[model samples]
Target chain A: MNIAEALKRTFPMKDLSQGKAASIFASVKSKMPAFVLKNNAPYRAVMTMDDYEILEWAHEYRLTHPGVVWAESLKWESEEDKDDHIALFNRLEATKNSGSLGGKELLDAVQKLAAQQ
Target chain B: MAEVDGRILDAVGRFAELSFLRMKPEALLADLQCLFELYGDSFEEVMDGVVKALKDIAQDRVTVSPMKYDLSQYSCYHFQSVVEQGQPADMRSLFKRAEDGTLEVEMIGNRFFPADIYTRATERIEYYLGDIGNMSE
Candidate 1:
């Protein structure tokens, strides 16, 4: 909501002449979230994928978890590329009681075996 | 003496091989609504006004909003989910994607699942064979 600082870099509508507009885009497309102003008011804004994704995820996480404050939940919105936990889930899911082990004993056995390795 | 259920483990392994993930328009649009609302009062006056100005293209994009983000992660809560497919259970390696993409769910994820069922299944298998050091760690 405190976007006053963000509004520092703005392109007035009349300034968007063809040649200048192309160069302006080239200058800010990568580092965007630039505002386009017309009649002294912002009309449209340009945003990069990174900026957009962060805002998108943050908004979604905020709405889904109402109790979580914006800044606190923003930390959890970054995308992680690893899936080791899921792999572990698979290995654990693939279990079947072929021998004598069935409940907690089985979990303990796996834990012990995992520990030794 | 409280142990795991053998049937549950068997079912999980068998079901892991299947893939049925679908997204409906309602759920998809709701996600977008949440995003637009980030601007608060400006959502309707400023943002929505832009859409109104470019209503044709904007409306079309809004219709296919679900396709915009081909999600890599899926935390299934319903029988037929839509954002993306649920993860496939393949315990072959330690770092491969869930059949393709990474799916990192929370400790309590999905309604159909009783949370971490895969872990239980793997434990049962290990308990039976009393082995798997080479495969899992």
Candidate 2:
């Protein structure tokens, strides 16, 4: 089902801009339900809402336990050569070519990441 | 995937450090490069992955005040009706399952968060990747 329909089934919502709908879809993807509306019908994609809620709780759970996690160690690659720059550029370009996942999920992802220690 | 994973961990470390101290997003764009790289293909997939991983890390160790958005507060904004509430703590395969004529829904309603939450979050990701404070260490 498209996002609008899916969302409609879950919540009493009004028509949303594609951008806003897309953003909400991203935010809720983490252990939350998101929907797309197509021809006024709900289509399902991604995980189940129950599962998404679990993930959301997990994020909340992590906030209380900050000592168990460990951080990774990365040495700065001091490579500023043209090739390295080009590779970074290539990666950026590749990602752009695909498209961006904006919305609340993106924002949630940001919040969850910030909570890490 | 190995290169990407490595870079992701590196950046995650930086984000962790920044988050530990509640820093801002002045350097968020730079710090988020690690997350941006890992989430290279689909923004949704990568973001979902980030949420999962961050939650995992938080649960494993360290303790901080959690930033929460009340699902009840912004109930009006939701489009879905019945969100599949999973195990209270497990986040492995949670998703929005569509039923006969309904779907689960929740709105973005975190009140404690600031307007620049995303920017701040990116900085946290950078701090974790950079291995700045590392309180556990």
Instruction: Report each candidate's C-alpha RMSD, comma-separated, in the order given.
Output: 19.9, 22.3
Per-residue accuracy of model 1 over A9-116 as CA lDDT, tens digit each: 688877787456776566565455668898898898777787788878976764453323321322323223113222332343333322223234433443342432
TM-score of chain B of 2: 0.25
lDDT of each: 0.34, 0.34
lDDT of 2 by residue, B73-108 (tens): 111211111123541221121112123311111111
The segments of candidate 1 whose C-alpha lies over 4 angstroms from its true place after superposition are A1-8, A29-32, A70-117, B1-137
Stretches off by above 4 angstroms in model 2 are A1-73, A81-117, B1-23, B52-137
Output the lDDT of residue B67, model 2: 28
Q: What is the TM-score of chain A in candidate 2?
A: 0.23
> Each candidate: how many clashes?
13, 68
